[model samples]
Target: MDLDRALSISAAGMAAQSTRLRVVAENLANRDSTGQTPGADPYRRRTVTFTNNMDRALGAPTLRASRIGTEPGAFPERYEPQHPAADERGYVKTPNVNSLMEVMDMREAQRSYGANLSVIETTRGMLMRTIEALRG
Candidate 1:
């Protein structure tokens, strides 16, 4: 039924968004993570890419978490000679992650996930009503 297909699509979307949220959370958690050794690179921000692929069983395009890759940017440097991760020049490399950007991405993912949840709920309700009508 069309309602079944709707549920499938929404479920896929929710799954994708959940993955995105997880990535965002990881970035936020490691925003301050630095390298253990001096002159080593710090933790880089991770990015999630979403793609739509054909679901042979469902015969529909579904959202998928295509890749979780590192963000390409220069890591910010802070002058902290006492830090273990400090370079020879007495500057420590900070993670490339921006807390504000991560938070914004998190908010967007949460909203997308919520919308998918709502669709699933509505589809289930419609299915239940249809079955009830059939019994009557």
Candidate 2:
């Protein structure tokens, strides 16, 4: 019920979403990265996992990025015989990062961040109104 509590919660949410956004950006940037050696693994897409932890200072549960982990799966291979990273079978392992999926994840993170920001703004407005009422 406290405005400060609301602000703290929203701030934690924003921080979590910010980490998600950063992970998405990193995945997109390294989407095309390939290993220099033949049969080597290419870049793996990184994922953000959030956890709800009790904030002793705020006395409320807040969200945080628990870990940044890589997505585990076989990389898609392309027939590129001449490529340095190509295997003996003439197949090159491509990054597991999917552009469309990353874009969707980015959009979701943006929406969450915007929602938290909106809450913070609303809390600020309510606090200002309360101050004015007391002054009157």
Candidate 3:
């Protein structure tokens, strides 16, 4: 692939990973969030989904976020009777976000972002060397 095309592909990948990281951060930040009113649902964990699309301009497949969906897992119930959000059964709905899972997802996103950055850097270096060789 051409240098510009390579850079475009890497940029697309970085953008996708950035979006994933943002969702994961939000989930972690709201892990303890509870509803303000009684019998209300707490924050549901958000998930990032990606899809591959053909980039006609670059003549390559690029990754894009298809949608930000909610996690299907059930929310946890905490026994906080005094809490205003508690239901009649004295249980409050807790966010589905799990600290460990969020941390792992964040790490994965970081690594993917880093990989895309490295690809861009390498492609730039190669292009510079090729131009220098042509000058000589």
The list of candidate 2 runs beyond 4 A from truth reads none
Off by over 4 Å in 3: none
TM-score of each: 0.97, 0.96, 0.96
Largest lDDT belongs to which candidate?
2
Q: Write the per-residue lDDT of candidate 2 for residues 1-136, one digit (tens) a residue.
A: 6789999999999999999999999999999998899999999999999999999988999999999999999999999999999999999999999999999999999999999999999999999999999999
In terms of lDDT, model 3 sits at 0.94
RMSD of each: 0.7, 1.1, 1.1
Q: How would you encode candidate 3's per-residue C-alpha lDDT over 66-109 as one tens digit per residue?
A: 89999887778999899999999999999998899999999999
Q: Which candidate has the top score in TM-score?
A: 1
| Residue lDDT tens for model 1, 22-118 | 9999999998899999988988999999999999889899999999999997889999999999988999999999999999999999999999999
Cα displacement (angstroms), candidate 2, residue 27, comes to 0.4
Error of 2 at 128 (Å): 1.1
Model 2's TM-score against the true structure:
0.96
Which pairs of residues collide in model 2?
none
